[model samples]
Target chain A: MVQRLDYLKESPSQTAGPYVHIGTNPNWVEITGVWKDDLGLVLVGPETVGERILVEGRIIDGSGALVRDALVEIWQADAAGLHNSPTETRGTADPAFAGWARQPVSDADGLFRFETIRPGRVPFSGGGLQAPHVTVWIVARGINLGLHTRLYFGDEAEANSVDPLLNRIPDPVRRATLVAPRTERDGMPVFTFDIRLQGDGETVFLDM
Target chain B: MSGAYFQRDRDWHPPALTPGYKTSVLRAPRQALLSMPTTPSEETGPVFGHDVLGPLDNDLIRNFAKDGGEAIGQRIVVYGRVLDENARPVAGALVEFWQANAGGRYRHKKESYLAAIDPNFGGCGRAITDAEGRYAFRTVKPGAYPWPNGVNDWRPAHIHFSVFGHAFAQRLITQMYFEGDPMIWQCPIVKTIPDPAAIERLVAALDRHETIPMDSLAYKFDIVLRGRRSTLFENRMEGN
Candidate 1:
């Protein structure tokens, strides 16, 4: 066995830019039939475990202007708290769930929406349970690198209060940025998660 | 182990002011939250394959003549290699690009119709990298256009490029400018890149040797992704 291992140095990052969507989601631009739909259009099917939910929000910049061209993607575990990954060693995850979704902000209102099931609590490698949450990745014009953050359910206050990662945040006020408040829009349950790219109420962007 | 150091650019990008230039509003804010340690979730990203690829008939110059029509402007070839920080080629990477027409007009609904549209030019192209991490595109030389950054402000002639490496986390998007374009020095968007080296990397050099001789002029721009500079994250110990 080798005593030491070497790794590749990470390359510097750059913004996703003015024409990202045209390249990534051609169908959305009226270029049709690339692959029926994008890869992350569905997070779960009828046979998947968990309550189906809709995640909606907008990407706001530092000046409080909506980022009309921003793209958002989410990844999470199934309702049983197991990831749909080939590397998952704990046990087999739900086969019906893909656990990922991607959407671009709408042109009219700059809002982005995803259809997925609410994720369940997952185990922390150390010793505790993490609150149920979904990881979100955001990219847009003027954004040098894709921003990383988490969206926790507002209704899951009990579990969130003691989440391993949540507890690491030094300020309670900043922690609030991660929670998606529950609301009703057009008679359907929606978790509103507005991402602030900068300024007064900047969303908590993770280092990774 | 060398300590992991991820220094946020103090000058590059938005939120940082560029002297004598406007147009940096709505950029991301600088905060402590962005500097916090990233978990495993942030480090790992999804893998992309043929599924996300565009149609095989995506070459812009060729498509420009699909209707037996011609795209207006100077024909040019832009080519490059996508490499990691280690200078190793990143094979099979996806490279996508979009730009304005020779008249500096985008073929989009939101764009103002002030500039004449080149019906033959779709203004978009994409290609997969070969084993050598090389990709190329054939298109017209885009024209400079006006923007709302400031009164009489104009964007330099540029083509936006997006590259997706093997992993999701390594995706990158940036604009490429023609070498020695005077507008680059004055454009706030180009000026926002803090580092001189980084700013220089955005420019594609004129490749006289690779020019199509009688057909088209060639330009080269090489992109380098982050190398093996993984952060030295400490192992989590219970009850630490």
Candidate 2:
């Protein structure tokens, strides 16, 4: 059969290149990028430790098997919407920004946790900062999966209404799914982002 | 922080969002066969070499490759299936395989195959199958190694397979080869491993159905990620 090359162009198989993800480069080892230190992207004169958010998640197989060696990677902007990467320009003062981190292995329970300062307000391409959000990438069993989502402060209702990313979503419940509740810790703010990689509570992703 | 990414202030209300973001996808619980996340960790440690791979090692190219630095094995074909609770082809699933090229060696930089010193057939390759969800590759069996733990172990000649289903959440990672393959029998990964031959309806059927390729034999590997009835484990918690 004569193959229509155009159809082949549309096949996702053509996308067999190494998945471009936020965390974990090549093997699961090494400390690369600006997210290496405690304050990921919070520019608080080095004093504002930013919000404390714990990203607990699992790596279950299609067979529902938890692969222990699986590595979890997360990249997010600080509460100020500024990424730690040199690229992110924050409303807070700091030109040296780097917005990324890599957590090599999940715990024995297939769980992973990250302690980062709240992201600051940074601008998107056409608009202003995206939701105070983080992007997640789960690499286990040699398979690289990409997941992008944002976390909103629990009571940041005013922000949610005008949040560039959230405002685009028309649904209430699904949009609500994107916002992580804000919890308090030692007079500091915290957001618990428990990621469900697959099945029921699998996180919703951005079009990109 | 700029007010751009604002949550509702006392005077503000949640802005109206588009329907697609929240409505494009709905989630349901995955069956058991495909959901193997709740299993436990079983690592007996370093098993290097001693597993037999049918045709992969016999690569006529092997003769021209490095000496002493080699992994050797037989050319045998094994078969199996990956089905839902009702037993169906998980088609389009992806499988990956990694093993020492015999001689219990890896072609990675850490393993010493650096272009600076040497470059060998110790690299890794992957393959995807047809609608049958079946896959095959040409590779040698694996060997075990002695680590700090101090044990006479050999890495299994197992192939690591990662499958992404129709949905992003339906993905799974697993391995398969043979029952008698030394690694399969003694490797730590086999403890929780189910009986390969008796894996219910989705068992991989040896493809006696086709002519064996001469270059390097072939294997019919299939994996069942999810569905109900026959104890399939779908990570319904993640919303597959």
Candidate 3:
């Protein structure tokens, strides 16, 4: 066996804390002019293609209190099921789509919202195609490490049934936590995914 | 092209339900995490360009200065290379950092610390790694602050770092403690990590060679991200 050099272990994780906004989203905190605007604020341009949609949710802790200090980030493929990353060698993703966004929870309501297009099906490394989904990561003052999870469309029931990731969790009720039911408001499609950090109905977090 | 896949070492990370860190009580998930192979989603990530950064983005000392006065505190320069586990340089990675002011107080309104905040010090800065995976930033040394986690617990002087690796699977958010700081070993958050060596990796060593004469000292803190599995392991898995 060819011996590999002793790899360096990962550094310990710490909480993002209450002041996370100052560093991640300086513009939002009134410390203007970091850039024209904060990065990840706009994932789609006017020319971007696909069905426009909005993903919104509130992060609730085990105590049933809203986590106002939380920061939520999303990464998803473009409408064509392609990523706008250099590692993506399959096909070019939509140049207009940024493919990522970060949003701090609302101070008043602890709600995090993202405006973007519906994503297409992405291929799983093992074999079959995965249902169209958005990868969600969350961090906050009390969160020691960033939590990883997924948001699947409840409307796509057929696709959701056979999703490789969703299938990994045998319990139907636990699996349902990953799917977000869709509703329409003001002529816009909105998917509500409430992430519970602990207790019953807690979201299925992934270890990638 | 699908590259080699490597599983995250679960043992390397601290458990989510540590009681010493009082916040983990209600925040930690009660259930176990579902392990999954890396998909295209995990292999790819967003790309940032140099055009997005302002000229003084890496200089915290003057980036938020008011009235032509710089931040108050001991000046220091932090520099290091972002590398993968295989020792390969990770270029063009975004490194964002924030910290308390010299008096151990944050600029936020909720800060109850008695220490006064320096008006000139915004206490945050960012830098992008070069082609060689090297990134450097200039700022004042942050002060240690006491928190409500315990009766009287003080966090060591540290800077919170958020780094983006080439892949989404490699993204990491951690803190860097100053070398020779006794408070590092006593902090409840630092004690959560099971491995002493891993905790040591979080400490940045003072590098006198890089220090500017009569100006600012330098600290070197190299970061290592998850690496792609070797091709040999891939062939073995396929029973080649």
Candidates' DockQ values? 0.34, 0.04, 0.62
Classified by CAPRI criteria, candidate 1 counts as acceptable
TM-score list, all predictions: 0.80, 0.39, 0.96
- DockQ for candidate 2: 0.04
Candidate 1, position A140, lDDT: 75
| Regions more than 4 Å wrong, model 3 | A1-4, B1-5, B232-240
Tens digits of per-residue lDDT, candidate 1, B91-189, equal 877787888889998776667839998877767777778889998878899999987666777889988877766443455677889998999888767
| Per-residue lDDT value at A83 in model 3 | 91
User: Runs in model 2 with CA error above 4 Å?
Assistant: A1-70, A73-208, B1-82, B109-118, B144-150, B194-214, B228-240
Interface RMSD of each: 4.3, 19.4, 2.3
Best by the TM-score measure:
3
Worst 10 residues of 2 chain A by lDDT: A7-16
TM-score pick, better of 2 and 3: 3
Q: How many residue pairs clash per model?
A: 15, 108, 0
